[model samples]
Target: MKNYDKYTREYFTPPVSSLKWTQKEYITAPPTWCSVDLRDGNQALVVPMNLQEKLEYFQLLLQIGFKEIEVGFPAASETEFAFLRTLIEQDLIPEDVTIQVLTQSREHIIRKTFEALQGVNKAIVHLYNSTSVAQREQVFRKSKAEIIDIAISGAELVKTCAAQTDGNFQFQYSPESFTGTEVEFALEICNRVLDVWQPTAQNKVIINLPATVSLSMPHIYASQIEYMSEHLNYRDHVILSLHPHNDRGTGVADAELGMLAGGQRVEGTLFGNGERTGNVDVITLALNLFSHGVNPHLHLENIPEIMSEYERLTRMKVSKRHPYAGELVFTAFSGSHQDAIAKGMKWREEGNGPHWSVPYLLIDPKDIGREYEGDIIRINSQSGKGGIGYVLEQNFGIDLPGEMREAVGYRVKGVSDRLHKELIPDEIYEIFIEEYVNITAPLELINYCFTHRDDYEATVSVRMGEELKEFTGVGNGRLDAISNALRTNLGMDYTNLVYKEHALEIGSESQAVTYIGITASEGTVYWGCGIDNDVMTSSVKALFSVVNKLHHSTSTQRLVNNR
Candidate 1:
């Protein structure tokens, strides 16, 4: 018979289809989480987060509903030891939040770990060892009995230490490569350790089973989890934990499978930053439940705050395109996506019944701390009539002519292809106002320039519509100087209109297109578009356009700041 470990690594097939479980099979449970940021995430980082950063992160973890935070290995480094000491001496560990420390099964290191948490109010000593065919044969070159002895001796040492400690101490043991280990041998070692510890329902022992080096297909991993779920003994007195790595890029699926197969606890870092392809992402898992109409213990709404704190502490920029927590996760750029999200949102707002739009949205952005209302994100050209009309309908309640949406779609495609970037709201507004809304003749900007020396200030020149209306002023960069020149010539803040530049093209160096929207006393939406090689010109043209929009809207519409 082929070793299932070797066979499973090569090919994995699901034991059953997802449809096998109905709605009744899906039950949300209060999850026990353990963040491996310090140990797992730190090792995986290119430049590891320092002690102070780790301390800040530790506090942030507590602020979130994560009760079990696995701090770094105190036995590893002076920095880790000092940070652990600071965490202990500062007396900051919450009553509910129990600090967990990881150590190898070795006696010296385990004692050093215990020494760090000596006075700490609450602590869990997590001890783990590699226990798989490959690890035993290659890593230690030890037989199965020899490996079990290593683990058993480690647990016995922990029991002795726990008896010695005055403060609250619990023991956690992980069969490091549990997913790939032989089931009967794995159970034997687990039951051996459990017998030594004598864990009860109230005093539950955590047995974390890591998919250490995720080597199986997603379904194989799921089957392994289900098989283990059905086999692991002391079912009531043990907290079955899962720690999956993204070696196969199926860590998320692996976690879902484990949970489905009856895992009560999960241990991972935020965004799954760890060794190799990293660990399973905890944030994604919890929010996945939130999308499925089930609640995860982790608050879905405090995501931004949590991310902000993590960023501040870790000094690592979360990619803007990262799911839910990213800057643009909810933003739709594709025509179909924007159109679908828009129509879905409209249907969602209709309070007559339950929503049918969860198709486009895998998880609701509201589950995380995002403020996206499914507004159709306009880009240069990849938009259809639905998206363009939606934007027009949103900005101004005036519905554009049907043919105009088609024309606008073509124009948008042209712009998108030319710009090579997503078109922003103000940019779309500018194009619409220019092409559709007939603004007879407003402030026409002819040309502008700045002449300045190394010692003195700068000058501004503007040619307004064939009429060379040039104003020379002295100030900083051409933007402020030009604005001052405008105030001097075009009158004061009587318009009560503000113009903000929204980028038409993305990238730091590329020209950021500005659309200036202004309001009138009567109320209207006037928009202008300015594209230039120079950013100052763009800013000035944007202001110039806002001045036009304010003038036109006041004449035709109602007031300023209309949605």
Candidate 2:
């Protein structure tokens, strides 16, 4: 903060203002994606990927549906040259995909780049040189005209080399650091390079405008792109491309806005991996299109698998919070967020519409190889009754009643808080079983038989601590009759006995589960669950479980009061 005055805005706005890109609402189609992972991304790595890793990463880019990939700056290193040769010699490059190689504006580098493309079926000869004012004044110490000459000479050499080379080639020119360059000067340099190539309809040239340092807001970049798109030479035969970096953490925004400004192609890395803050994340850009109902044309159905392969090959970890591919992107830990997600999922399941409009989720996790259980509703201390209940119903087919879920949620949250860890589905199930299901301590139902008399007569065998006894009572129903018998023989006074039953649909179809809730004299309701092959037996067990819970709660409270 103290040195804030030391830095000033270095980006140059276009002389002519064109904000037409603002009228467009969204990108109706995905741009032509060119991955620079092997080149820009590898150069930034602390330990550059080996030959084998580059090969594997290239294959991965192919699988992700990149039509054009900048393999590397072949002239920069023997390893880069070898990797390009390996792709060509081993016939690893797919017919539909075009491999690109970066080169400086020098003649030898251009010639060496062409040499690396010796037998390639199709390739793009990418030529670049720094054109920003900073580079002109400090780095290259050259005038704008001299910088333009460098790009033109490189374009001429690349053109001559392509004519002599055996491979099919296209020309690409980048005014490196285009964002910091004056827009008028940037356009002039690109057009001069285009003059040397004279690209045709069949072999259109790429004019890449890279925000090499991301010196301004996204709108300024968009305006600069629009100016170039409108004023470029051989406009019909030029492909406007954007290569944005993440120095300002808005690479994705810059790419999106550039596309909206008539830029056709994008050159970026998989997860924004490159020099410094990294390149624009192609994954984020493509998935952003996908979320807006546009087909990104990339096979991203299994993001986890892609992330694993990327981390393994690049030796870089994808952050757990990374968009669409992170481990916790779909997980909800907040109670309110979990509740909304649970309810939204239910609403969607009931045929709400064809659209994915779930609350707290931009897109369905299952659409990208993630599931609801374990991934969506994570059970932490901040979890709510809705999410807990939804998790139970989805994973274990044990749907807690609406009134009972809150009490169960509190108990589960207490356990998780004490343990200081998230509860897995199995752990949550175990907690449910230990705390609420078939609990028998002070009162246990050893046996029960029912007979139909005037109003459902019941004979029940019960155990209380060390004593076992038999009791009989009649009520309108079997569970009521049993409750009446228990209340009379055990001198337990309670009312409003609630019971509900459902057949277990997950592990055992034949087993029936029943839930019971009883209100004590103090207006507190204790809940319990029971599972058995017979519905009547499960109902009786459930009643006993609730009675035991009530007795334990009362005893614990009395002890606390005495203390």
Candidate 3:
């Protein structure tokens, strides 16, 4: 706080701009994505990736459908140069892919970069120079004219090297600190390089404007990109690209807005890994577009595999809360959130057509290889009846009645609260079975014979502990008559019996599951479940289980109140 006076806004604002990119609501299409993981991202690592690691990462980039990849700065290191040679000599570079290498505005490095590209089919000789005001004054000690001359000289040398090299080459130029440089100066230097390359309809040039260090809000950068796109030389022949770093945690925002401002390509890393905060996350950016019903043109169907490989090779961990890719991004733990998500999923299941409007979920988890039961409705102390019931119905095919769900929900929450952890689907099912399914305790139904006539009658044999007793009661329905037999034999009393049944298909064939709930005299409700191959037997077991639960709970509550 004491040094707050020393820092102020250091970013340069471009001349008054009438911005049009704001009118667009979203990115209409995918941009040409170039992964800089091998270069920009690798350099930022504490222990940079080795040759084999780089090779593995290169294959991953290809698998993700990156057309252009900045493999490395060959002139900077022997390993970088060797990686390029290995890819070229081993025929690893795909015919459709183009490898790009970086260099500064020097002659020998430029020559060495070309040497690394020898015998390659296609390559992009990326030439860049620090053109920021700070770099010109402090680092280079050069004037504006001198800086422009540096870029121009690099452009000419790249052109010469491409002609002499034994490989096909394209040209790319970057104002390294475009965000910190004056907008007009950035344009002027890029145009000077364009004038040298003379890009045509058949052969296009890339003009990359990097937010080497984020200096302002994203819209300001978008405006800068728009100004350059509108006034750049040979606009049709130039591919305006954006390389945003996440120093401000808005790299994705900058890339999206920049595309709207006429940029056609993005250069970033897998999970935004780079120097300070890292580069823009190409995965997040592409998937954001995918969520809006636009195909990102990249294969990100299996994100878990991608994240695993990325972390293994890079020694970096993707956060559990990262957008669209994190483990917990789609998971709901709050009771209300889980309830809504469960209801929304049910609505989708019951609907007649395809629509992805699930509440609290922007995209379907299944699209990215995530399971709905495990990943969506997670169970914890905060989970509710709807989510818990949904988990059972979806994974285990046991549907609880409305009031039974509430009772079971509280029981599950109590267990989770005492254990201080979240419960998995198996654990939840085990709790359900242990607590409510076919419980035979103070009372157990031994046998039942029913007679259906104008009025229903039944002779039921039940066990009260070690003793067996028979009771005959008559009622309008078979189940009601059975209830009447229990009351006549054991003096049982309850009301408002409710039940639900469904076929249990998971790990079972021809299995039926039934749930029952009953209200005792004190307005306390108890729930139970029974699973069997016969629906009638399952229903009888469910009724007996609920009766036992009610008797045990009432006795326990009475004992505790007396104490």
Can you give the lDDT of residue 314 in candidate 2? 75
Give the whole-model CA lDDT for all candidates, comma-separated: 0.70, 0.89, 0.89
Indicate the residue-level lDDT of 184 in model 2: 92
RMSD of each: 15.0, 13.3, 13.7
List ranges where model 3 is wrong by over 4 Å: 375-563
Residue-level lDDT of model 3, residues 368-425, one tens digit each, is 7776556455677766677798888788877777777788888898898899888998
- The estimated TM-scores of all candidates read 0.65, 0.68, 0.68
lDDT of 2 by residue, 311-343 (tens): 767778788689987766788889999999999
Residues 1-563 of candidate 1 have per-residue lDDT tens digits of: 65655653432333434322223355466458899988898888778888878888887777667899999899999988988899888887888888889988999998888888778888888988888887888889999899889889999998888777667887788888876687666777887778778888777888887888887766566566565556557778888888899998888888887777667788888877788988988888777776667777775576766775665555555665666776567777798988877777777787645743544666667655565664423443434555666675566443444534565666766776687776776787676667533232455666667767642233444445556666655556565566556656765333333444444433334555554444444454445445556666776776665565554445454344553
Clashing residue pairs for model 2: none
After the best TM-score superposition of candidate 2, give how far the Cα of residue 319 lies from its true spot, in angstroms.
1.2
Q: What is the lDDT of residue 281 in candidate 2?
A: 97
